[model samples]
Target: MSKKNRKFLATTVTAAAVAAVLAPSVSADELKFTDVSDTYADAVNFLVGNGITKGVEDTKFGTHQNITRVDAAVLVARALGFDENGKYKDAGFTDVPDRAKWAVNALVQNNVVDGLSTTKFGSYDNLTRGQTAKLLANAAKLPVNDGVTKTKFTDVNENFAKYVDALVREGVTKGKEETKFGANDAVKRGELALFLDRAKEHFGFFDLFVMHTNDTHAKADMGPKRATAVKELRSEHKNNLLVDAGDVFSGTLYFNEFQGAADLQMMNYMGYDAMTFGNHEFDLGSSEEGHKALASFVKNAKFPMLSANLDFSKDELFIGLQNNRYTSDYSNGIYDGIVVDVNGEEVGIFGLTTEETPTISSTGEVQFANYVEKAKEAVAAFEARGVDKIIALTHLGYNDSLNFDNDLELAKKVEGIDIIVGGHTHSELKDPVVSNEFDAPTIIVQAGTQSKYLGTLNAVFNEDGVVTSFGGELVKVGDFEADAKAEEILAPYKKKVDELMNQSTGVSTEVALDGGRDSNNEGNSSVRHNETNLGNLITDGMLATAKTINDKTTIAMQNGGGIRASIDEGDITVGEVMTVLPFGNALAIMELKGSEIKAALEHSVSADLRDDKTGLKESGAFLHVSGLKFEYDSSKPAGERVTKVEVSEGDKFVALDDAKTYFVATNTFTAAGGDGYDMFGKAYADGRVSEPGNVDYQMFIDYLNVLDKVAPAVEGRIVDVNPAAAKTVAE
Candidate 1:
């Protein structure tokens, strides 16, 4: 990734603090297991009434006692129901002193313990404040300290650093002073009562908060400040949502560990509502196995895996991937959309992957269809079921030129879709890019790549199901304090990823990437418009990697959108590279007649369907490419916009003939004529490639990191062919 990109990703670290107090309730209900004479009656009653803690004996309420480490574990495990699994039956520990045997087995079986020095359980050891905080926070599944970033405790140094800060954030623990954690202090039974009480308050309420982390690319651990940031969001938002926008497969060596199983588990613990699959979801190298692993990972999903475009009717992998494994359980997608009653309002969500599956997905036996067609069908289905307040989860990128009117067009054409919470392109829309698709307007958003930013949207819907007013922003992952609960959930993965991301790659001259549009005199900027050494390096890598299969390959064309990220000028790591190129999109070379190529060129120049409603600069796929050069005048009418065209051979521009056939390399999206490149569609209605992976964003970073300095300047690769003097070319 570029230094600017890394800096951009790192900019989210500003932490904010909020005060959270345990709200009280009035109830005189008798405690079933406790007598009125119990010394801990008030504390126990308060906890039991709020559903926080329960009694262990018929008449004895252990209140003033210093709870044993074993006792604390049991209370926490039972409260969270962590001991129900049969997987911990063989759990063995040497230091539990038999008296704490049940607690040791329960904690160990639930993955709540880091091995206590090999075979020892350390049960006889007094639980320090730090240890107690960690255990209670994890058991309650609450944010470490309600997402507070850092505290000012004088005594809490880095040694007890792990729990003091996190526990305080989650409201589970507050150390002795501004500078002291009192790490050796024992947590009394009454103190535990307070922690459990707060957890119960947050859990029992219906207030909902939704969080999402899309296109993970197998990084598994939080990227930069993401883990900390999302955790904070959950704690701050109170009711929360954490989601992945698919593409969780492939990318790093972590996937090699259980084939992306651990990543799914991490996401589950982080609490995802629903995740939409990206093309990379097929990268187990086996569609069936990949599907099975996906199912297995979500075996204990608190949410569902929603995908409406690709029909899994014949796929063995989706045997029972729906909600609750019920035959008619369309609870999430009764109308091709899930209705979530968040804070009392209903939120309708639908999901669709880019229809470019034959080229991008390794479905083995799975078949895919056109996203536009499926989206139309799905939306129609939702409409039929009275779900008008719709949000589409799309994996399609935003292209300025090839405007066959996909998502952007859908934003305008479709009527019910209020927001398009999009993934795939990794384009960061800091503000909602309002789509004039309907009278109500569609709010579209994307949070670049990785877990760098949390996209937030607030829509005010009237009783009519139309968006009355809507606004959204991308919150940098570093801006909020890490949510303690999220931290505890991700702690294991974070450590593992730290070991993986810390290794360096190389450095560069300057920040070398600009992902959006280029506004310079050439219609593209040096940093943004033309392919940088980074884009060239990536495209070149694809060509080099693919040539191992086809020596006959001449020129390769990688869609700009598919080039996910740039290699920043700095130390690079394998994980950073994968983040850029997360998908397994491979290279494909197709045979096209020169006439078909001319048609493709024409489609690109005029692809920007500019009308008064949508300004000239608003065409979705207006950007062109490498290997070819083109010029156009928007002043000219549509179909007559281009004035000249040329292809480069070595360093010289060559005139082209429309009758000859040539080999071209590109991805399945453009090849399928997705952006109104009908000539390509007509020529290769059956066009295809056999490669299973694309270098994606990370490959470009890897390529750049290998080269200490990069020079990414745009060369006039694609030129225009004018209509006024085109007699030299055939009609």
Candidate 2:
């Protein structure tokens, strides 16, 4: 039978149920209702409320009687205000006899039912769940959010795709979370109510300040927690916005495997209002194909991409859907800036990225113009166009010291920008740092790299759209409830990464770890300290590895900042090591004059001496070095603290002279004099140094795997100097 006829027939059979509503004066127990008491009760109440159904008599709701197709159609038509107004011929249903002709005509005219065959209507079939949802959704004139692309849902296969898609998108139905939508199941009255409520919420509009995220690096779930804080603020003020700063792309292997497809999906499911690009968005290798892949990854996104800087005019990456582009720079095309409505106020947003694209982005060709200049122009245009409230979605670094050309400088230089939501040098701003250089306060914020932190800024704008008063907080990921939808999206990808990392490598006695110096922030000891066992293990491991490569190589030296994290006591794996040493830098073998080595030693020693955080002075050298021993005088000044230096030739201490050269193994960064090692870095520039592969972490791991149990201990590698007591005060 045709679908129309089946619907018509089902309508006829259910017409009695639809029309009968128990009278308020009568008790439900006395009301004559159907066998499905729960369904009937709800249906009766709803129908009666909506004026679709009425009781058979004062107290009789005749729900049990099988409803004919014609009766169902007439009742439904009456509810829809189609009584006699909607005209229809005597639609011939094979089973519907002439006696019920008016009902059939009414059903057919309302488009709620049709004959089973060209000349017959099956008017006695019961309505199923799938059919019920579709009918209700259509009756309400709801809009379906069927994505422009398809996903992998078993139940949403070809045959019922359209109806299922519409019902699900219109919020009339839901799959059994983590399971397929059972389309064939019988419809329940309770489920129907939920569908209706959801549909209403979907169509009902409310002013919203939406915050969103993308490419959080491996920040492993920080977005959810920060979003919660923002949500709380949103609830209180009823006007707020939160969003992600990007690059959730490549630094971590978790992002490498799924190409961040799962991450982006989670962001979309979390109801993010918008997103901008990060350099890592081009990590998969930016070509037409790579950009296309990224585009596809975000294709399910309901919100649009806002990249005012990228020019995709000639790039195949943006060929077809130019509408996806949104800013003032491009007018004939879709502009990148969006005016988000907040309680009758329009707030404009534009996105910008760092100019370091040429060096950092691995994917498709990226062209970045002067962000500060472009931003100033954009803001001026927004103001001229009468858009007072403005926000810049920036992927600029927060610590300009780390990223020489940072966006914070941009914020300082630009006058009209209200808020600079920044990323890149992932800084965890516990609170918003207000920039007063601009006429109005320019707030700068960033979630630390990896999904570990989320940055939120709250602003109260004046009539001119400049922020008069504002504050922000950085939220830790552990603080909030993980959005269920985000969890669902991440499950598979997380499972895959877990499977890969769970393979055991070695175990530690206990957690021997410390997250080293964070370049993104100002502090050093949090990640870079002499006390961290991680630093000890890494330097020792490098020394051990160098011994294998060069028997003459003594004392492996590793920068404190290079020691990523301590190996916590537990099942260790290759993945953890990779995470600790993601740079893949290589070891460099250098011959340095004794005096120069001593000077290099003085730099770190001094930095550690005056450093209030870690008491590294009592711990010899802050820089983990093997094959060398020295002591320091805690009472002496920094550069003069190292009093004595000794070199060991396998258990023997030897005298060292300033003119003599010692062969040492350390990272190229050090050899090039990074971290105040000007002497070493300058050595390489003078062609007195040699270096190896860019992947240094591999060498450390190889050294570790070979040892049955590597035990690294602190020796008196550095000696302290004290002036032989003054002839003195005693005399």
Candidate 3:
């Protein structure tokens, strides 16, 4: 057979396998077959008992006879749950006899078999070993051979090479010998029976299928679609696990209005097994109201909220929320790890949140330990309990610029973890990153943010609990139809959010206010790197709000990382504004010397300026200024990157006087020195900052209300002295 022909046949058999849905088991003792080898007698009896075959006679079995094409089809069809008595129309093969028509028609209708020609069934033609391997491999729906390129058997044609390898990988069949499959050799009755039996056992083996998502950020629209995909995948595979890598809060109007209720409801509907806390999960933890929101989200979550490194012992809000505490023994709840039985095998799972949560979000009284150290303890704990396969549910990000403990680093430093489902960087990895730096294979995967994609990883583990073969793919949630149940659950929350979303903010923009993180020269809208129109609009709001109290507040700055989304050109609604600035941060004003401002700028660009060969670095701390301008070079050293700084004075740009104190406006997150801005943190601690009691998004709304039409563009507020070098850094 040609490669094209083999692919066509494989597709046919795979479809048949999916439709068949074979039953649990069949008793081999019920079958009595004569003239069978002792090694193959049980296998032949298994096939006979399943109605896949019958002896040549009641007392005699044709174990030595060459299996025919029709014989092979009947066995495969029966193994795949085809009933001979079913109402199947006669296949259009003219040469097929009526006695064998049922089996041929069933296989043909399911695309498992094609006629030898357009009209001839070729029912009597002897089935070859290569052909038998192809049929059995396809019927089992075994993963396609990835590493096997050349044929293991010299006699096997390239067309049948992959099929043979797949069969070998599944332990269904080895070649007739070590290096010779005897491609054209006819399969005897006993040998065919053994192949079918092994194939059935291969299907019975427990393979783990994990469907995961992360960083949904309250995109409730993705809930129903993601539920649909998870449902379909769970139905298709056994021993399946569904998980979330956290960051389900703080992005759109849904989170702002419902306070993660809608997102949690959706997750509950999807039946998540486990979840970890992302930094955004702690975004609403400053007051009782914020703590209540988090408490409510945790109360409603049906699954365990895992975090091994967090010391929630000192926190009252999370008094009873700890799933499992770190100790020699493990229970369930918010613990270091938990072991769940997956098809009779205990799968140990643990969770890890980034250690930088306290500095980035309002993680009050929740001290965090080193992720790597905690991970080691979790692995050891699981292994002590005889659990060999361990999975790490983490929010450490894929690779972050802040030199934080990321997933890739975790995989390298840790020894026992088998898989790491991660989030926080919002990276869309089409392929799972396989790292073999430790004792076992560590597969790392993260679906992109906002519920746009659903990641599925199927892994086959050996008896020792080590992964031997793996396959993964990201299922696009947008491509799937929304589940009615998920949508119904979200209806009430949607109505409330819809009301707030439709409220017009009384501002229209001629161009989109871009807040994306991509490095494009068109608008430089990625607030993480350079000045953006949206950033300017936001800081202008802060400056205007601050000026109400102190007229001397000349400079306004906002962290690029704090700006979430962009607004397209047209009528802007309150919902769009909320989506762009969903953290619910309040406006703050602070007094800082010109020299202090320059030092802050230097700290802001330090991550990007420090070249560890990662190219252009992005820091959420990268300041977007309204009344100040500065230029930096990527080729310069980290602390000395900012060469020139100036502030706007009476419609004219003047050099910043290091000795002069100026009032500056920014969000409380920045004023408190979130994103590693230590200077701002120290200044705020010294009573140089004052709270204006204004919500950040409300400030933007008030600022926009004064303008009939708003169109802010990126100007020379932020200049890269070496533009070419900066582009390299961005790349």
Candidate 4:
């Protein structure tokens, strides 16, 4: 057999043997045996839960009882998947009773133990330390020390010295005392339990449960549900870690009003271990009030905020915030990475935020570095500190191409990361994506956006920290019971949110203004794909608001992603409007050449949808426009997709003049290069754009107030010209 296979067999057999003897057969509630040490309670409970051993009587474990040869044989047999009914050739042993026949036969058949004289099995004899070591070493299939002549143990017989050495080499034992094996001493039940637990750990048979969430987006109401999950999971698994992969800010009226305070309270109450920063975390750092909101979030958070690549030293707002220069303490509030001990095992965890933060959000003076490089450095640092199990908590999207680092790329490039909890693309990964790019396995998982799902990834690793087995699933938070304490914490916040939600804007809609993208005109609606009345209403509001600043403002646009939710057919409230535009972006008016406008349009639909057999669909960058009409052919290349573009000239539509400049209105996020709008960002940087000092949602609210009974309809402002054709768009 190959060396790798041999090693695997050795560890597997050792784990099996240890697990069989020490695995728990009942719950802690049913464990009446009370002699276990407080420090080894979990270990002893594991033994009982796995059904490896049972109490000597109905309510007594006989912790001081001496183990016999037959007792050891029975445990080893059961661990190796053999039972009393398992068929095996009978070993002719005179002394082994019929009750011990199966165990003796199993041991003899498996070549783990033999009879004293090929005919007499000493089944009732008390098992000695050296004899037990020999049996365990043989059962584990450890390599024989054929060349060793010296004995490390003072009292171990020469015949059993090799077995004791093998046991020590495997970390299964270190002898009863420093230099003595106590070769002739009887093995006690407690000593046996300790040995089995150590062997199980040495072979990496222990459980590690990781509970994580991403893109929560200030759904503080779901805090109780998340807390319920964490509490239940922690009870079931002794080794558990709770972490968030960022985007804890924005998305609802709660965030708009409380500005992450409510979320921070809930997170602390739920006992979050660590969290990474998402782009939304920096969304409010540009203005003084916004900066204070972020500062408050950091100050109130009980857990560490991790960002290895971000340089916050230059940012004055973050003064005195603990930076993870060399420490791993979570109380510091800011850290690059941390080494946490879980059930006596060291777990190294680090964070990575997308480098696209500066262009996508208001990061102020904080700068970002390459995610891959930072990840490599973190891994090296952790490894230097003797940490093997590494987890990368990231806000990088699962898969995106805005020059932003993504989870899949990070997993493939960085070798040591065993798990990647990610967010930012709002992807709902039902199952973990396991990538074996290096020698070890890297698991990438993301829960769906908006606290809708909580992801749990349970993994089993070998001694070398390589993932040997793993399984994961997203748990629907709606199915879980909410914690009462969390609900009590959110009661005041909810009361304030309700007041905002109750205020009617008087713009009653007759239909569910479709913001959802239903590309084929099917019932499946999605704002990211097809045009809708809601998109029209939002863009028209921007255009009208911009016109108040500059009469020359002729067109307005908004990325579908910025539109968070759809308004139901009823009286709209300020809360609903806030939820729809929760990013708090201001209106930006810019002067761009007609050619640049067309280029922006081309960039909007540049996402490739042909691979999914859905032509020109489901791109968040899909533009919602007002005061302009355009048609694109999906079969054409990206830059050349826009075949016809027209601008409103009085009551007539005129073809766009390629060289003429026109004033356009959009959200500051889009105008400053959010959603890959490079041309718009450049124009703003070059003094070609001006801020109108109008909050995006306030502009919509104002427009709603102007038109008391608002009704918006799709008027063919944007059209898909090769609508029936299934073709690819050039990258």
In order, the Cα lDDT scores of the candidates are 0.53, 0.55, 0.76, 0.76
In the range 23-119, model 1's lDDT, one tens digit per residue, is 1111212324343333434335444532334454544445545666766666666555443343455466666665446656777666665445767
lDDT of 4 by residue, 480-546 (tens): 9989998999899989988877877667777676655454336345677667899999999999988
How many Å off is the CA of 235 in candidate 2? 3.1
CA error at residue 707 for candidate 2, angstroms: 16
**Two-way TM-score contest, 1 vs 3, winner:** 3
Question: Could you tell which candidate, 2 or 3, scores higher by TM-score?
Answer: 3
Models 1 onward score TM values of: 0.47, 0.49, 0.55, 0.58
Candidate 3 segments exceeding 4 Å error: 1-206, 325-332, 504-535, 539-572, 576-731
lDDT of 4 at 603: 95
Query: Considering lDDT, which of the candidate structures 1 and 2 is the better prediction for this target?
Result: 2
Taking the tens digit of each residue's C-alpha lDDT, what string does model 3 give over 513-555? 8888765534333678777888888998889878876789999
lDDT for model 4, please: 0.76
